[model samples]
Target: MYDAVEALEGRQFDVVYTGKGALCYLPDFAQWADVVHQLLKPGGSLYIVEFHPLLNAMGSVALPGDTDDLIIRNDYLEGRGAIAHDTTVTYTGDQIPGRQRSFEWMHSLGEVVTTLAATGFQITRLRESEVLQWPRFNGMHQTPKGWWRLPDEAPRIPLLYALLATKSD
Candidate 1:
């Protein structure tokens, strides 16, 4: 529920961050762009560090059910509607007990970049690093340089990522 384009008529803010909260749940990119543009002040910066949407498209074999505690996926690729489940996520930090699950959309890395560029925000610095703060992937371990890429025996896939950019003056 946002009239982003209309709000741009006369208003501004120092920063417009759209990563951690419900914004990331946006089902439409064009609309999300509006919110980012209107909420940003002149020369202000926009930093979005979100979970890799591509990772969201994965089809897992995690156990299934509410009390059973397992996988929770909603066919976002089809977009019929969210087929939510009850399962708790076990992250490195905040490994809260219990089980609860929900549906999520998939946005490729390119999609994320293109969406921002289309919004008038210049790509300042794009860095792809392993999970730094709290890794959700079981295959992510820290290293001297930073979060190590190698999770198990061989390092092949990346855990999570971040994006940093600023609005052009």
Candidate 2:
């Protein structure tokens, strides 16, 4: 990873895009922001389309005997440190034969925007959507566009969010 960073040194990119379920693995926003800032050219942009922090905090695990209900099962903010999980099942209906452990950190929207701002990026756009790429919950339905969404009667929530930030010349 350090070698990749070094190879890109002094390089400028017109745009950088990061997708869903990526940010949770990053432990330090400041370090990430520094790398992004270094990669962008003057007036270049960074676009992040990711799962909303609220959705991450709520998690995709169905409540016991209540797969229809969404619950806050994790931290919504950063101060609590990393969360560790041990599982033998994968999200794609595959079962792992051996134990697996993973660690993740929750980052609020405020933290994202602030980190970019501190790194000298100007926030251009921010959008939140109720659409998801898969059925995160038991009763979600897929739309014509292939995205999943909560049923009409379910309370609306932001499942995904996108932000655009530009490095000024």
Candidate 3:
């Protein structure tokens, strides 16, 4: 991450993209948000696609049995809480390996909005979707766009959201 920033530091850009990969693993959203704002050109836009915290809580580790077997099975009310799970994911040029250790911090729908607002971005749109690009868990209804959804459990609420913000022109 440092290398990527160093390459961009001092160079003007029109748009900056950030994703907390796998589980929105942003230990410090404020710091990253601040850096992204700094790199933007006047009238630039920031297109951020983040995984809903609920997806984070449900460990990514694939289960040997049904997909439901791997989830934390909680409503996912946003706040500070502890969830321990073995998440299966692929790392850059490497595999996460089965049973890798990972942690996630829950942020409510409102929390994401407020956090970005405090960072000085004007909200243009908050789009939601249940599209599962990759398999996050088992028992998900497959969609053409690769979204795995719990048709019976959660149809209205999405498992991910994309937020678009812009700097004051």
Candidate 4:
């Protein structure tokens, strides 16, 4: 996985876009930042929109036979090592044919920004949103734009975030 981006170094880009379920799969953010830096030209920009680490830590929000309670079921920061997940069933409730496994790592908001900045990327903008692309909580309601968010009574917390940075010239 580390060598995958090395090939892309030959090509320079003005903008690199990545996010969502992407970061969790990556075991190392520093390596990722360095590789991304190598792919971009001087002053190039990198935009990332991902699920907040807090979202990964919380549990029982909206699952089968689960309540609406905000529970801390997992780590909010990386360093504990990879989290193994059963891949037999997908998040959409679809059943797969064979048994499979996958691993993920939680990257906190601070870690993400720090890694990028440490790689010499100029932090431009970071936005956190309470809305999610899917109904993550039992009381979540769909917005006008079709996104989902907790109801007025539920405590507001960021479920997703977008970060924008630029490489120094």
lDDT of 1 by residue, 1-169 (tens): 3675465665777776655434345667557765776677868777777655434543335655423211334332433444344556533235557775654445556777787788787888776654544444444567765554445454344335567666665
Enumerate residue pairs that collide in model 1.
87-99, 87-100, 87-101, 88-99, 88-100
What TM-score would you give candidate 3 relative to the actual structure?
Answer: 0.69
lDDT of 4 by residue, 1-169 (tens): 4575666547889998996889999998899888888888899999999999999999875677866789899999889999999788876768998977889998999899999998999999999999999997677899999999989888899999999999986
Say which prediction, candidate 2 or candidate 3, comes out ahead on lDDT: 2
lDDT of 2: 0.85
lDDT of 3 by residue, 50-89 (tens): 7776665555345565344445555465555544446575
Cα error, residue 118 of model 4, in Å, equals 0.6
Question: Which has the greatest lDDT?
Answer: 4
Give lDDT per model, in order: 0.57, 0.85, 0.65, 0.89
Per-prediction CA RMSD (Å) = 6.1, 2.1, 4.6, 2.3
Question: Which 10-residue span in candidate 2 carries the lowest summed lDDT?
Answer: 1-10
* Models ranked on TM-score: 4, 2, 3, 1
> Over 4 Å off in model 4, which ranges?
61-66, 91-93
Q: Name the better of 3 and 4 by lDDT.
A: 4
Model 2, 18-126: lDDT tens digits are 8888888888867887887788888989999988999887755554765557788888888788899888986565899998888888889999999899889999999
